[model samples]
Target: MSLLDIDGVSVDLGRAPLTRVLDEVSLRLRAGEVVGVVGESGSGKTTLARSILRSVPVAAGSLRIDGRDVRGLRGGTLRAWRREGAVQYVFQDPLRSLDPGVRVVDSIAEGLRIARVPSEERTRRIAAALRDVGLDPELAGRLPGHLSGGQRQRAAIARALVMQPRLLLLDEPVSALDAASRDRIIRTLIALRDAHRERLGMLVISHDIGSLAALSDRLVVLYRGRIVEDGPTRQVVARPRHPYTRLLIASVPVIGVAGADRTERAALRAAIDA
Candidate 1:
């Protein structure tokens, strides 16, 4: 059975006059797979993520995890779904989800605490989570404000990882950082996925093709609230079937071009493609 199944899902926001945010989106993510959803702003990528997490009410279709219908859950059942680490979310803005004053270890331990894990076990898991995200275990004692953006994001990833969820929903996880920091965070996520491939599946939502190209095994491109293309990561990026996908690939900055002439030509080509 698929670890995460989303079928013909649609989401409507507002009451009186509704706006369809997601439209008949269907996706299946298997255990250990990394799938990326890419689109421009307002393309319903985030809404789709929220739909999977059940933060938004689905207007149509069904959502399932491990063959269990998530929409049928309520109250304690829903809480149990989260507490048991069946699925976890790591948002785009790490600071929004991570408290500034809290110690790194404690922030990461919040989920475990809710699950009522013993203090001793929480400590061990916290350290392991930090290590899993490629951070020094000693750094857990520091406050959030003391860490670099990349470190803080890694800390955020650790917080989600500590839950030991089967699937992770990441909404632009590295889009908030500087170039160097973005690269570092992306590497950390890929390493985490590689290390726990058998037990973890991930859904990364981003407009950054490079980030998704590096981390995801498959890519699903969204345009105006619907999937325009879905295929293997390399295949889609290399030879895009949809025009939107082509625009995304053409936007990837070609690095290490030192000569002024080649750089100028490449820049012009990118501009033309755009």
Candidate 2:
């Protein structure tokens, strides 16, 4: 069975003339597969992630994880499923996700604590998780504010890793960092996925096509709250099937041709608006 299945799902937000953010979206993720969801702002990428976590109301269709209906879960059952941490989310901002006042180790141990893991086991898992993300155990004593952007991001990743999640969802995981930091974080994620691919699947949401191209097995492009294209990463990048997808690629700033990239991107935006 697929680890995560989202079939013909639609989400509507706000009241009175509700706005439809997701329209008949169907996606399936298997264990060990890394799928990238890329799109411009207001494209429902974050909403899609929220739907999987059951953070938003689904107006139509079904969302299932490991063959269980996520939308049908209620009360303690839903809480317990969430505590199990089968689905872990790494927010775009690590500083916001990790408590500034809490020590890194404590933040990483929070999920295990809520799950009632023993002290010794939690400690072991926390150490292992930190190591998995290329963080030294000694750094665990520091607060989120003390670490560099990449380090803090890894710490956030470690917190998720400790849960041993079957499906991990990352929202723009590297977009807030400098180029070097972004590269390091991406490499860390790539290595982590490679090491845990047998049981771990990931859906990464980002506007950065270049990063997604490097880390994703397949790419799913969202435009105006709907999927415009879905295919192998290389294939989508090499030959985009949709106009929006092509414009997204063209917007990426090439090393020495950033000026042209910006101009093309602006023109594409104008055309899209028209």
- lDDT of each residue in 18-65, candidate 2, tens digit only: 999999999889998999999989999999999999899898998989
Residue 247 in model 2: lDDT: 81
Candidates in order have lDDT scores of: 0.85, 0.90
lDDT of 1 at 1: 87
Which candidate gets the maximum lDDT versus the true structure? 2
Q: Superposing all C-alpha atoms, what RMSD in Å does each candidate have to the true structure?
A: 4.0, 2.1
Q: Give the lDDT of residue 217 in candidate 2.
A: 94
What value does the lDDT take at residue 44 in candidate 2?
98
lDDT against true structure, model 2: 0.90
Estimate the TM-score for candidate 1.
0.91
Candidate 2: deviation at residue 270, Å? 6.9
Model 2: residues with Cα > 4 Å off, grouped in runs: 253-274
Q: How far does residue 61 in candidate 1 sit from its true spot (Å)?
A: 0.6
